[model samples]
Target: MKPSFRLLSTVAAAALVCCASSSVLAQSKFVLKLAHADSADLGTSRKAVMADTFAKEVKAKSGGRIDVQIFGAGALGGEREVVEGVKNGFIQAGLASGVMANFFPGAMVTDIPYLFPSDEVADKVMDGPFGQKLSADFNAATGMHNLCFGEVGFRHFSSGKKPIHSPKDLVGMKIRVQETPLYVTEMKALGAQPTPIAFPETYTALQTGVVDGQENPIPTLIFAKFYEVQKNVTLDGHNYGIDWFVLSDKFYKSLPPDLLKVVTDAGKVACAEERKVNRTFTANGNKTMADKGVTVYTPTAAELAEFRAAAQPPVIEFLKTKIDPKLIDSIQTAVKDADAKK
Candidate 1:
């Protein structure tokens, strides 16, 4: 009972159709949406702009099969909120730090005062074995995969009320700090009353005398126009900030191997470029604060050491309640290693 030629040809045609459908299914496209809480500008928002570069690179490299969409400036809420969204698979990716310490307490290690001697030392420590461990710890705690780290520069103190030449100058001053316990502890230890304020309201907070002073990288102070309201600036370099480029474990797992490589490579490129911009701003752009009528003050080595003695020990004691001191010790060791190399 052999089939006729027409029947055999019809069976072969159906099999071919099934194979074509399977091939199409295997090559399905993936779209991931990444978010950040910066106003949409490369000049002001280093991480936001670089995260966008990650988006563009993913699209171009995936040949349109993978799309990384970006939402900036609280479009999906602040950094901590977006971090929650990503962990739940409600969002794909983001660039965040600060309140992220709440989710992954180990993250606050990066904010420890007087940790890095200079930007070069900080960079070496962060890109070395020490940083790798922190990234792994962060991934374990929060389920977000770190791609690369971008710089947030060193935070300095500025005041609208008075010039801060020493820790004594900060006494009786009301200082605004990011909504983090460690920052609060740091200010209290330095003899200032710490006011926890949201990022968006800081300028007005300064102008209206709600807060006498605040601390942040010079670039951020310039970008946010803090110089307009705060006339006194001091280079304290108390804390080094890191922008973590991360993808949700859920979204990362969804990608096929090839597309993952594309995302990872793009992240590295964006990280490098953003750090470069940060360094350049620290060297040249910071002088603008003085030009804009904000009195810029550089602390002597002895004065800065007084600040370190006053602020760091108490903050470390405070952090011991939240984070592993062992981790902090390891980081200190790494910083020393970096300094030794220099």
Candidate 2:
């Protein structure tokens, strides 16, 4: 009563095909959420635009194996809250700013005023070995991954008072600063009464005279409508404000090898694209602010040097207490190397 060999072969082949189709149906897909502090519709918000780029790139690169859900305008929470969510696996990713120092004190390296000579240099270093090393250390310390540095462009001074020409002008002025000790120290060193204020509260703080001035990159100043409340904006480019895209160690490691590669690749592409957006907005942002009646000041070389000289030394000393000098030396070396190519 044995079956024919051809019949047996056909039955086995059908069973194998069924199993293969079932396996395909049962394969797991990943869903990741990215949180940031601005509205998705805010064209000038680099984080928002960057999240869009990352989401599209990751989805395309993963071939529907991954889905990125973006919660902007602090829908998930503030920068610190979002970072904490990433750290604890409550959220998968976030766009975090200097507040990252809360978890990795070494992040203070980014806070040094006048750090990166140019956006190009910052990109070269942050995407290179030094940034990778720092990012690795951050991952090891806090169970989170710093995917890459996205741009916040260069910070400039703006005031309801007069235009800022030198540190002396900042003296006695009450300035709104990110509620971080590093910034408090830098503004104090520059002679402003550094008033730590929440980012959401800043515009109202300015309007009410709770603070006379604030500092942020050009596009931010304009989009945040600081231009409406402030008359003079200085173009000192005092600091290159580097923002980070972070992922949870748990979520990142959970990805299969091929998917992990796709995510990492998407990170680099998205970061570069965000930098382009920041650069474009910043280049023409001065004119935008001027159109809003903001008096823009471009300092002479001597005037800028005065501001940088007065601002750097003490902050370098302050950073020494928080970060190793060797790491700082490493950053400067990377910058010099990046610049040497010019």
Candidate 3:
């Protein structure tokens, strides 16, 4: 028997309604787990604030439908493990530093020493087009959504034995670095023997004299108690370390459109707050370290020039061979444009 046209149309409409209803119901049941290797107290740490803010906003925007569970201080695992877990979908998200670069070699470009002149310059470059493109590229390659970049601040040299004012001073020194090729190459180019070590184990390495010194932001030195074992802190500000907020693409794609928007918006807000907190913490850490009897050394213009002149060429040449030369040029141009605006 042939069905009437009206009857067939009616049946199709009902099926469409059923599918729409099912999708809405599924969207309402989403949840995400975010983790990081920092303590929950945000007193002076921006990363902590970012993690907390993201969780709160996601819940509020999704009307508590999309629950975001945050684990701090390596509760889930270390940075590298957390990133891997995200990729495999065991964990939904994580905030990781350069160590995560080992999985994405393009990220290594940002870690080049003396590349950024100041915090202001770093902020301008990373928040601009270049950073946005890199974030997208990382997402495409790793199947992880790159939300926004958080700050780890500029890394400086701190040693127990000597004050580092120029490249010559670092000669033959065994300096601790993250397990990134760029860091190892940078340190080697500057005449220091690079020693790769995990962040959580750095203080012990310094204390036990397993390594002569290490480089990290002032706030990190204070937070991790590196100042206790290292007497001299040099404000060389050699490299800019950025923290990446990476989320599982599989999990994100499963979310409803509305919930996905909420997650992205929340990440943007959290990134801004985290930047402010990091900057303030860095400023205050200097004074805190001084009060704790750690000597702070600032290099003279001539001394800084010498270090820059020595490190830049080798890094530039090495990058050309490893990465697209045009990409390196674009990064340099972006940085120059950013500096000119200031």
- Colliding residue pairs in candidate 2: none
Model 2 per-residue lDDT tens digits across residues 1-342: 256888999999999999999887566588899899776774767888899999999988888889899999989988889999999999998997777888898888876787777787888888899999999988888888888888878899999978888889999999998877777888988999999898879999999999999999988886788888999999888888778889998898788899888888888888888899888889778888878888889888898778778788888888898878887888879888988985
Residue 245, candidate 3: alpha-carbon lDDT:
91
Candidate 3 clashing pairs, residues 3+ apart or interchain: none
Local distance difference test values of all predictions, in order:
0.86, 0.86, 0.85
- Candidate 1, residues 37-141: lDDT per residue as tens digits? 877777667866787788788888988888777898879998878888988989988888675676788888888898888988988888899988988998888
lDDT for 56 (candidate 1): 80
Model 1 residue 60 CA deviation in Å: 3.4
Pairs that collide in candidate 1 are: none
Model 3 over residues 1-342: C-alpha lDDT tens digits?
256888998899999999999998875787688998878787955667999988888888878888888888889988888999999998988899866666777787786668888778888888899989888888877788889888888889999988888889899999999776677878998999999998879889999999999998888888898889999999988888888999997888887788789999999888888888888898899988899899999999888888888887788788777766777777788888899899
lDDT (0-100) at residue 307 of candidate 1? 92
TM-score per model over all chains: 0.91, 0.91, 0.88
lDDT, residue 272, candidate 1 = 83
Cα lDDT of candidate 3 equals: 0.85
